[model samples]
Target: MQKKLLFLCLFLFVEVITAQQDILSEQAEISVLTIGPGALLNDSFGHNAFRVKDPVKGIDLAFNYGVYDFETPNFYLKFAQGKLNYLIGLNYYEDFFEAYISQNRSIKEQVLNLSQIEKQKLFDYLLNNIKPENRRYLYDFFYDNCATKIKDVTNIALNNSIQFNDPRDFKPQTFRELIHSNLNRNSWGCFGIDLALGSVIDKKATPEEHMFLPKYIYRFFEVATIKNSNKPLIKKSNVLYEKIDAPVPSQFLTSPLFIFGILGGFILFITYTDFKKQKQSVWLDITLFSLTGIIGILILLLWFATDHKGTHQNYNLLWACALNILVIGQLLKQKTSTWFIKYLKFLVILLCLLTLHWIIGVQVFAIGLIPFLIALFIRYLFLIKYYSNRH
Candidate 1:
């Protein structure tokens, strides 16, 4: 009796699952039948050799059921069948580029609210253990799953000796010639897609399976350097600083102006205060003010979230620098007998040196990392001097 009951439950479960799958299949079919041909022209029409359907005229290019439709110009309007068909295409295409082997670890941690420093620490640790050869193996494994099949299908037209495809003509040839051909293709996206997809796929296939599409060809070409042994080590490119655009120049002035104004006002207030009558606990006052100012600025920056460009309202390093200045100012306000001024003056000079390092394209984390290291060394020297003198 127990065996019969278990069998009955299993039968019901199978029925439910089958029903769900049927519903999904039906939905997919309906979507492909509905969205017209306009979407095809927008996305895949010029890129692939496949047929694209027309919505209004009912003229089918490749498939009868699935088609693209445009609800508005420029904006991609959602269509059911169009998306369903596209998913099928993507599933097939993902087998070609196969780059996303691991779920992007950075993005996953971001959802958990991990700080940048924490992320960097984790990434650095992971990177150290993952040797260059292992990285190549991982990439090769991904290619085996995706690119090998694509290259096999596409390379039928090409000569067997070809390692890379010609951008103008999908002929197999040397990597240098392939790079030159791709660079000449103008669009980065075109190069990116072609290189990623082409690298993995097989070298020999019929024309229908292998011919390189014009769209997204440039994307694959530009990113070829990424795949090569010579990866770009520099994070910031010289091209970024070439143009003096809006908000950048404005932001530069804004930070300094606000800093100077408050500083000047504080100086005047101190001058006006009663001369010799006050018993000043200068060190204590300075420490308290600096602590309070730091806390206040941190709170403000956290709350405000608006930065120079206004493209994104986030508290980046610039906000931190501004806050640091305020804290330093507060520290300077106290008439302490200690060498706080000298310490701060040295820090300022160090910061200037670091800024110069960054401007000249130094391979350091922050703008003034080099200078910060120098300051630490100087501090160590001072510590040794103080101890030696006391002894």
Candidate 2:
């Protein structure tokens, strides 16, 4: 009995000592590392992570919230459904920097002006978050992404005492515009975003909401203050690495603008031929209606069925009308229904409304779509005239 009690006491003493030793030392430092954007779509918006370095404790680790486990079941489906889980990843600080460096991306670090106790608290919180059960979180592009995670965790560590002052050069912009700043306006990525996302992103984003992007996090942190004491939040800043310039070769033939321009030219040519011949092309009408209808169906599905918040309330439906599908049978008939002409007229009116929406800032559309919209308008006009002449 005495031997067992002695062993238990020793075990308890060792556990207490180990627990106490886990605390961060006064010399430890915590920083926010902002990685510049890479060439890939996934890395275009850049990334943010926490760096905890303690030379005395021989500890140097980076806590990143942007990692996704592609090996997860139904990865692509889950990503499309917005149900993919992003997990907190821990890596050695040197390894993390090296990876970014190899990609030719810049790295910037900001040492936060937190009290020693606050620093230790922040370190402890990050360590706790990296635990197996606590690591995974439902990823949200606008709200709970890597940059927002860093902002949120810092706020938590400071007990919500951080006051983010807007930087002097700050300009309020819509979420879509903010995203566009990082992407080439003529690129396929920009076109896809304008197509998939809806009008909800047209509203101006709040200053705090701007932290969703990593660069904004760095900018806001540079001017942020402690709420209680009104002290600056960042003590020092350093540029760890600067990206070297390497220009990407451009290919105009494969670009969206060029391809869409060709498509629009063909549409105009077909419409002109139909006008001169005083006859409609059955195949052309079928192709146009079918393609637009399919696109409309896809838009509707993305808006209603998908978990993507930005896809809701889309107004692109005005041009890609789903009603086009129902009237496809009329094109095959020798003489169409009386209401079919009116339907074509209605489509023309809807196109006008789409222009109105664009002008009034109801939604911003892809610039590459301009030629397509013009061609579609002219095609509808031709159809209206053809039906009227036959009637």
Candidate 3:
């Protein structure tokens, strides 16, 4: 009798869940939420989420594809290796809105003009996707991120029946340019990005690919339409919260350009002093070699050791040569070999090649590194001369 009762309860539970599958009433609404950028680097590109509301079913929730658990096994390691998985998150719509609003970020909502069937399909899809097994997805910065997922999932739900029209002021831009649009050019974040990421990001992104950003997601969706019929995709759009304008904080003192500029000047000053005395600063040479060698090794590791595609095709290796580390013993010698002078010349040639790469638009390096590169060039020339004289 107890076994039969347990079986009956299980059957009823399945039936209840099955019934709720199509429970969304005709009054259901689906919308996209665009949250504005925050001050932090992580939030600078903004965010996107889907808002699903069904008054009859008392279902109001936000669905986003940008979540990742910090406690995941090998989290930081996977993140650095670009092997981390990001998860789709489900939350109450009110909580989602309040969270962004509390951060003083602007929020915009676009009510989609999806058919009742399409709405239910999308809502159900989200419900199914939030399952533990289905929640995680391999996250790619350019191809498949939170913003791109919005378009991807919608098209999947609608069976690719939507057409995205270009905005009035649409313009083509490279991925790096697109990223730079959302960042301060001289900011430390930008400097680090330029240093770590390579030239692949300089390639142009397609119109659809531009939707990888949340702002572009909002822009394209605003002008999108149904394919079979030219019906608009967005029925209504409104700003839920508008951030008050505030004075931009000056970053000059803390910026990469400023810091690198000062360091570069010091290097030139030391080189000038060494040149005047007709004597080399052995300690300075050792320090510079060690720093450049370490940086070069790191770049090589980022390119070959990691799964990050953006770190490939780096030309910064021209300046930061790993061979410099192996030659530190030569620099320590009072009277070094003649080949050491030739090696210094070889380093200069690599710098010239780097310049050629830059001029030909092969790779766009960090502009903030300009002063440092110039200083490095002069120092290299001085070292070559000093070593040649000793030889």
Which one is best on lDDT? 2
TM-score of each: 0.22, 0.94, 0.94
Candidate 2 per-residue lDDT over residues 78-177, each given as its tens digit:
8988889998877778878999999999999999998988998888787667666787899999999999999999999899999999999799999999
Q: lDDT tens digits, residues 111-154, model 1?
A: 11112332233223222222222221111211121223223322
> How does residue 334 of candidate 2 score in lDDT?
92
RMSD of 2: 6.6
Question: lDDT by residue for model 3 over 1-391, one digit each (tens)?
Answer: 6544643553454346456655678999999999999989989999999998888877777889999766689999999899999988777688788889889999999999988889878877877787667878988888899999999999988899989999988998999999999999999888888888888988888999999899999999999998979999999999999998889978799788888899899999999999899988888889889999999999999999999999998888999898999999998888999988899899999999999988988887888898889998999999888878777
Estimate the TM-score for candidate 1.
Answer: 0.22
- Number of clashes recorded per candidate: 40, 0, 0
Candidate achieving higher lDDT, 2 or 3: 2
Looking at model 2, which ten-residue stretch has the lowest summed lDDT? 6-15
Q: Cα deviation in Å at residue 108, candidate 1?
A: 29
TM-score of 3: 0.94
Q: Runs in model 3 with CA error above 4 Å?
A: 1-19
Candidate 2 local Cα displacement, residue 341, angstroms: 1.2
- For model 2, what is the error of residue 232's alpha carbon versus the real structure, in angstroms, after optimal superposition? 1.0
